[model samples]
Target: MADLLTPGLILAAAATFLFAGLVKGVTGMGLPTFAMAVLGSLVSPAAAAALLIVPSFVTNLWQLLAGPAFAGLARRLWPMMAGIVAGTFAGASLLASGDTGASTAALGATLVAYAAWSLLGRQPRAPARLERWASPIVGLATGLVTGATGVFVVPAVPYLQALDLEKDDLVQALGLSFTVSTLALAGALAVRGAYQVGDLAVSTFAVLPALAGMWLGQEIRRRVSPAAFRRWFLVGLLLLGAEMLLRPLF
Candidate 1:
């Protein structure tokens, strides 16, 4: 922990976590996306992943404990969870084997494309019969992306939106998805012996800033109109997509 306490690094990490949390709290997603984009610029991919683990866990802990929605989410999303677990394992193995730059690039491009689709593409509604299968497919794709790039929302958000869930339920859905993906990614990092005590300590320290940001974002959300929220969400998606696309270039 002391090793990571350098003033400059600590300050930067705190700022990054704060920004990420604000995005997630207001938007109900983007914590991982924002964290990885900013932190990855400063640390190795594995280190960035490790540093996010604890903060992500802390952020989701509130959602998991605050609601009764998990059961309904589970019932509606079991197949998706199964697929995510499987895909997460596959992605983790790839990371554990060695370098994951290629995987990261691929995942980033996929995220950019998906973000575009969500903003502009007309998605077909899931058939009544196919609704049962939607979760698994979404889960698998999200898991793969989560494992490879720590960016899972890109795949999960559209599907959840298409379900026409109430805002609270959608929040719960995202919270659940993030919770599962975080655990899977942690396990994968463990298997690859990528777990670093210092990283976890730093990540834990980051939680203070994250929570603070979330509180502020919630306050901001109260003042924003629904249409404004939608516009900002699109803007955020475009910026994040551009960030992902330009990541490997630097």
Candidate 2:
């Protein structure tokens, strides 16, 4: 923790969170993915995961409550959420084992895949009949990925989109899922002894900048084309992913 708080690192973290929040604001997701991508490159994936807990939980909680369809979404998504917790707990040690190189490469690969999928703008729909069986499987896969990389946007986000939910319901659904993932990830990190007093303090401080960035992003969204912004964002993420993937090899 002491080593991570060097003035340069602190500044880098603040900037990273701010940019992450900006993406989340525009796309209604990407906070964790962007943070993990950038911070995992700067620090270990385990350390970056710890730092994102507070901001991610707080913002996603707000998103969860801001809508009127909480009851229905909760009822529909409980199994998947449960699977997330179970899977995260089951794979909790993947990131905690002090294998930074492997985790960083995993994180890079995830970002690259997700960014490519989003760039293609292909929104595959899951039929209503399949939800009964598909949800838990998706949740488990998502949790395993989250456990390993601290990024929960892979199959989970795509699965959520495939539900063909109404726009607002989809957004609220994402909030619910992310909130659960954050809580589960936090527990996993704690079990692995990644959360220390100094780390918690820095993480807490990051929340403010994240919120501010989100606010700014919302304002920007009102004026700019979200689709355009998202396209560019994915491009940058793809490049970042390439760098992360190649980093250890050199």
Candidate 3:
């Protein structure tokens, strides 16, 4: 892993984070997923995960705070958040074990499933009664996936969507969920001894570009059609996921 951090690679990573941030700015999500997907192709999934900590955390924290109903949302989502932290801790070693091949495959598979779900416009419903039991389960599953593959938008996002939240509420919920996932993943990396000092510095510096791109993306969102951009984004994720899924064969 030490040998992996060349200057050129670091530069590329900064640029990637910028683009990922842009995507999130436009859509309110996808920063982690897009960055991890592209960076996993350039670096190991574990390394990519390390790079994401600061930028993802900052952006998501902002998103989480921008909503009007923070206290209520947190109260409602506590069970799920706790489950995510516990499950992430449990499965952390899978990602930190230097098993790049398996981690990449897992990530690719996750991206594919998410993209397909979005593209197909499938919105599974979960009643209010189901939230008590379902939230924790979804969080645990999402955390396990995050710990394994450095991506955290599987069953959790879909499950949240299933609850039929209003548009503003849904965006804030995603921010809250992702913020928790980022923190948990960071903890997992620390416990696994995968978060190196130098990587932390780079991750911090990368935040600048990420924020810049996000600002630009917000401007574009005001002018461009977000629905069209999201369509293209999903398509790109689908293709990227397919490539990674077949990477071992090639």
Best by lDDT: 3
The candidate, 1 or 3, that scores higher on lDDT is 3
For each candidate, what TM-score against the reference?
A: 0.85, 0.97, 0.96
Model 2 — which ten-residue stretch has the worst lDDT? 1-10
**Weakest lDDT window of 10 consecutive positions for candidate 3:** 1-10
lDDT of 1 by residue, 174-229 (tens): 78777888888888787778766666766788899999888877887788764566
Task: Please give the ranking of all candidate structures by TM-score, highest first, separated by commas.
Answer: 2, 3, 1
lDDT of 2: 0.88
Could you give candidate 3's per-residue lDDT for residues 1-250 as a string of tens digits? 4557889897888789889989987987889999999999998899999989999999999999998888988999999999999989887888899987888888899999999999996678999998999999999999999999889899888998998988888888999999999999999889889987777777898799899989988988999998899999999999999898889877
Ranking by lDDT: 3, 2, 1
Please state the error at residue 50 of candidate 2 in Å. 0.7
lDDT for residue 57 in candidate 1, whole number 0-100: 84
Query: Which tens-of-lDDT digit does each residue in 1-250 have in candidate 2?
Result: 5456688988999999898888888878888888988888888999999899889999899889998899999999999999899888776687888899888888899999999999986789999999998999999988998898898887899999999998999999999999999999989888888776677777899998899889988988999999999999999999999888888899
Candidate number that wins on lDDT, 2 or 3: 3
Candidate 3 colliding pairs: none
lDDT of 2 at 68: 80
Q: Clashing pairs in model 1?
A: 80-135, 80-136
